[model samples]
Target: MSVTRHKVWDPLVRIFHWSLVIAFAANALFTDPESNLHEWIGYVVVALIAIRILWGVVGTRYARFTSFPPSASGALGQLSDIATGRKRAHLGHTPLGAMMIYNLLLTMLAIGVSGYMMTTNAYWGVDWVEELHEIFVTWAEISIVLHIGAVIWESLRTGVNLPRAMVSGVKTVPEGIKIEP
Candidate 1:
């Protein structure tokens, strides 16, 4: 039986994801302690993050948060599957993956908001806000590393390259799975 391919993530979402990845990675590595480049990168990240949140609510079917939010129970259920190595192939994000998506978004938002606050007069030179901003960035980095690792592992396990799927917006489903366009 031939597996059918369906459009999952939209082009805009894919572009946003990759672009944010590049920008965030660059911001993390290339920004100097006293340079303005980091601030500019933070601004771009903030805009991208805000746009993505809006898109989550009004984006394409597979891209919408409603389509794949993993409830607490759902996430726990996947833990068993992961333990048993009996993971089900999903046309979109799996339960754990969905949670990671939410985490990444929220963490990025926190980092961006805190970083922005440090530039404002009310918060400028406030040592505590700077410390909090640094903490947020650290979490964002850790979350991103975990997210990439999961993507790689899932791709290898399922024989489906997730990055490729995001780029193409088309994913090949298993023969027994039915994707409704």
Candidate 2:
């Protein structure tokens, strides 16, 4: 198969992607819930996501939300393609991937807001708030796992190295593949 490299992810997008990954992972796995480090990291996570939301509005061609708007029918179509053993690649984010991006973005926002709430006198020592925060974190953890699995699955199915693309800002898609815009 012939190969063609597309500059799909810009540097800011890549940085935000990896930084979010690291910050989320640290908070989820390493940091103590009551520690100052955990709270600081939570703020960092919120800030990164805030910047990403702005970037999605005015970023590069493929980085903008317009490039990969979330669509339910499109996501269903992607699932149908998978079930039919059809290999279609997306030049940027696939519809399903876009949905996940939106999900994760909203989830992170929930986690951040809930986390922040826990810090306030109003919410401090409130059991429901703590439970809600934990629930959001759990959902984020599950979503992250699924995201990784989908990336690997799509990469293998479409002959694309998705993780590498995220890291290096390029998608070396195989030539002649059916690419969804």
Candidate 3:
């Protein structure tokens, strides 16, 4: 069967997505925590998240928050589909994926805020603030791992190239795949 391709992620969204990946990885894995580079990368992450939030409000169809609003029922439905071995390709983010997006956004924001606070006189040398930042970073790391696994699982299940879609802004759905509207 033939494949039908549709543009889903926009250019800004794709850029933000990959930029966050690099920024987060650099700070979490490579950068020296006490150095200026780490602080700058943290700020970059904050800026990227801010841009993404704005784009979610005023960007293209797939980038808008309205396109994939957080819903308990929607998440449950997706879980059910998985349990029942049903394949459904979502035009934008699946409900579970939407939840992950919110999770990462909030988690990243928390990390950024805490990291900034550590640099302030009021919060500097505060053990709790530093610990809180570490906690958020750990959570974000766990969430990132889950996010990657879910993307791979969903891509194979629905026969969609999810990573490629994010990079190219288009998803090529197989003809017989059930696509969520």
- TM-score per model over all chains: 0.91, 0.98, 0.99
* Tens digit per residue, CA lDDT, model 3, 1-181: 8999998988899999999999999999999999999999999999999999999999999999999999999999999999999889999999999999999999999999999999999999999999999999999999999999999999998899999999999999999889886
Task: Give lDDT tens digits, candidate 2, residues 23-100.
Answer: 999999998889999999999999999999999998898989998998999999999999999888898999999999
Candidate 1 is scored at a TM of 0.91
Name the candidate that leads on lDDT. 3
Model 2 C-alpha lDDT versus the unseen true structure: 0.93
Tens digit per residue, CA lDDT, model 1, 1-181: 5666777888889999889989998889987856799888888988998898898899988778888876788788767767877646677788888999888888888888888888899999999998998898898888888988988987776666788898999887666533322
lDDT: worst 10-residue window of model 1: 172-181
Question: Which regions of candidate 3 are displaced past 4 Å?
Answer: none
Task: Specify the highest-TM-score model's number.
Answer: 3
**Poorest stretch of ten by lDDT in candidate 2:** 172-181
